[model samples]
Target: MSKICEICGRKPHAGNQISHSAKKSTRWWHPNIQKVRVKLPDGRVKRMKICTRCLKAGKVQKAVS
Candidate 1:
């Protein structure tokens, strides 16, 4: 699964991690993406990778287990 939100288009952000000694280390802030099944406009359920924020915001309807 890709690290992208199908609903909000959220992607991984690059940044640095600062240590106590003022040392900087490169890192990535990846979104909390999950594979889920969403209902499409045509009533077809499709699987996609979406971030937790979008899921919490109800941007897409998750498929019933």
Candidate 2:
């Protein structure tokens, strides 16, 4: 699967890691994602990949049915 959050569309960020010796290396920062079943507008449950921020912020509603 792609390294992207379906809810927030967050993707991996590329950057560099600096060492004490002044050496730099490529690095990537990926968002924390989780798959969950959420309630839709039509009252249907659907599985989607969401980020931790959204989950913690109560942006996603869990499907009851």
Candidate 3:
């Protein structure tokens, strides 16, 4: 499964990792994605990949049993 936010359409971020010896290596900073049960507009609960930021911002409503 891909680490992408379904609500915000966020993807992984590419960057370089530097060591103490000044050596650079390629690395990716992935977003905090989680599979949450979301409540749709029709009151149906479905699992989706969502990011923490969007969850905190109330972009999607979580289904609570």
Global CA lDDT computed for model 2: 0.87
What are the clashing pairs of model 2? none
**lDDT (10s digit) by residue, model 3, range 1-65:** 89999988999989999999999999999999999999999999999999999999999999998
Cα lDDT, all candidates: 0.88, 0.87, 0.95
Cα-based lDDT at residue 24, candidate 1 = 100
Error of 1 at 22 (Å): 0.4
RMSD of each: 1.1, 1.3, 1.0
Model 2 residue 7 lDDT?
79
Tens digits of per-residue lDDT, candidate 1, 1-65, equal 67988788889889999999999999999899998899887889999998899889888998786
After superposing candidate 3, which stretches have Cα over 4 Å from the reference? Answer: none
What's the TM-score of each model vs. the native? 0.89, 0.89, 0.89
Please estimate how well model 3 matches the true structure, expressed as its whole-model Cα lDDT. Answer: 0.95
Q: How accurate is candidate 1 locally (lDDT)?
A: 0.88
Worst 10 residues of 2 by lDDT: 1-10
Give the residue spans of candidate 1 off by over 4 A. none
